[model samples]
Target: MNNNPRQLAFIILQEIHRKQAFADFALDKYLRKNDLIDANRRLVTELVYGCVRRERSLDAIIDELAKKKSHQQNPDLRIILHIGLYQLSYLEQIPESAAVDTTVELAKQNKF
Candidate 1:
């Protein structure tokens, strides 16, 4: 799997959803284990927690835009889309291009 912040966020989401893991615990575990730089660590934290916080709304959007329902989408792709949509809708400081590019890269990695 890819190791960029976006990819890491997707993995964290997968752990939370698939393993029924606590968001904070999964995030902290990955943060500690990965040796990510400060910016990436912060981004991962934001994406993981942000996605968790806004999951319902994000899924609503996913349901509208995606051909497949959220549950039917690849788990990895769902998480990646969550991160991308979260960044687009909530984190205005992030450039749209960067968010879309990273998310697309993540989807590609997962063969979405």
Candidate 2:
């Protein structure tokens, strides 16, 4: 499995969506299994929890911005969007370009 923080966040969110897994449990499981650096581990935790906490607001923005509603979009794509938007909107330290580029790259990597 990919150890990149964003990639790991994607997998955790996918598990939450598909299996209704608890965020903390899934995150802890992955964090324990992977030898992520402190910063990377923090990023993964922030991305997963932030997305979950802000899901409603994110979906609202997504529905307004996308041609398709959030629920109508592919689940993985929606999660990717959430990751990007969370970083862009909440993580002031992250450059907007990096957020957009990484999120787009994730979508491409997933063959979306």
For residues 1-112, could you state the per-residue lDDT of candidate 1 as single tens digits? 3358887888888999999999999998888778788988988899999999999999999999989999788777778889999999999999999889988888888887
Off by over 4 Å in 1: 1-3
Candidate 2 residue spans exceeding 4 A from truth = none
Worst 10 residues of 1 by lDDT: 1-10
List of clashing residue pairs for candidate 2: none
Per-residue alpha-carbon lDDT of model 2 for 1-112, expressed as tens digits?
5578999999999999999999999999999999998999999999999999999999999999999999999999999999999999999989999999999988988898
Candidate 2 has its poorest 10 consecutive residues by lDDT at 1-10
